[model samples]
Target: MFDPDEIRGMLISAAQQRMALTYSEVLHALGHRFTRPLMRQLCKVLDAIDEDGRAAGEPGLAVLVVRQSDGLPGQGWFVARSGSHADLPLDWEGTEARRYVEARQGEAFDYWATR
Candidate 1:
């Protein structure tokens, strides 16, 4: 059974490796089956990080992006921090960030496809 801290740690490790994981990828990494409740719990962990960042007046430890994928329910990208870097703007609306995230997503897709 995976706890929230374990999930969070996995996410951070992925980020350190410079990989942007989707909900499915995260579950796969943890050897868990996909389920609605599990997805919700993962989102809650991301949200908690966001809330903590807001309360502490800092940037979030991760960023979540909602993306459309036909076969996946609640498809999105979760990117965690790699290291010391500039914090995203507190008022971040994701318009500018999406470009980078999408590019990375494409790279991830290409990588797995080739493997």
Candidate 2:
């Protein structure tokens, strides 16, 4: 069984350390290498974490997990945003996308970096 809290704790630790982790880095932290199944399950757990955080009025933790090349969350994060991401552009590309992503990531860092 996947321990969501374990992953949550790792994300929190990353926030505490004030840094974003690549998907592979997160998997390695959990003692697993990169795999499609693990990545999917990890995204599911991260979505749940974001939901719980939203309920508690906290920044999304999943923003801290991102692509290694671009340092941006995967497409799932954008697609899952019902209306909470209205501020972001529709196309979700270029400087606008980078600013939006960095803002969200900054929220997570600022919220948890000192806590």
Candidate 3:
């Protein structure tokens, strides 16, 4: 019985710490079992957070979650602050996280410049 807010907090903490986490890692951290419905709910919550951040003009705080094709863990997520050059953890997988930030560079700049 994991709360969505708890998951959101975990993501924020991970971003602040400049780390990435897999779905399994998140589940283990919460002491929860793996279930498809829970996974779907997590994804939905992440999407809502992303939208909310964008609407608030603080879009860079959004975490990027990607489904991996490697089949080991199946999915992973990362939080990368805009303009940060901090190195991600060695265990962090996927180019999607980096791509996610790169994709939003212009929007982030625009938001900050207008603020």
Candidate 4:
């Protein structure tokens, strides 16, 4: 079974490196290939990570895991956003979404760098 904490660590490393990993890259790190089922499972873990981050006043770590096509999180990620991120645009493939993701990713990258 995939472990959420382990994936979280991977995301932390990416954040510190100030780089985004494609969904396939994330799964590959775990010795798996991209599949809808596995991707969904990863998304669930990402949601949990963001939920925990929210409680801790940290930026969303899932922002570091994105689609290679547009360098943005999948639609599932936008759908899962809540709390302070509830105001995100409904359109995921546009400039608004890009800026929102960049800012969130920057926060994680900057915050992780300080640790």
Q: What is the lDDT of every predicted structure here?
A: 0.50, 0.84, 0.52, 0.90
lDDT by residue for model 3 (1-115), tens: 4576777677666655555566666766778665777776666666667666757657543343333344122223333222243543334345654554445443444444444
- Arrange candidates, best lDDT first: 4, 2, 3, 1
How do the residues 1-115 of candidate 1 rate in per-residue lDDT, one tens digit apiece?
4566776566455545545556767666778776768777777676676556458654333443232252112322233332333542222235445554445445434433432
Assess the local accuracy of residue 59 in candidate 1 as a C-alpha lDDT between 0 and 100. Answer: 36
**Whose TM-score is greatest here?**
4
TM-score of 3: 0.52
Per residue, candidate 4 scores C-alpha lDDT tens digits across 1-112 of 7898999999999999999999999999999999999999999989899889889988889989999898999998887774356678878879999998998899999999
Model 1 residue 21 CA deviation in Å: 0.7
Best by lDDT: 4
Clashing pairs for model 4 are: none
Q: Once superposed on the true structure, which residue ranges of model 1 sit more than 4 Å away at CA?
A: 53-58, 64-97, 100-115
Q: Can you tell me which runs of candidate 4 are displaced by over 4 Å?
A: 82-86
**Per-residue error at 13 for model 2, in Å?**
1.4
Error of 1 at 76 (Å): 9.2
Worst lDDT 10-window in candidate 1:
70-79
lDDT for 16 in candidate 2 is 85
Can you tell me which runs of candidate 3 are displaced by over 4 Å?
Answer: 60-115
- For candidate 3, the clash count comes to 0
Clashes per model (N, Cα, C within 3 A)? 0, 0, 0, 0
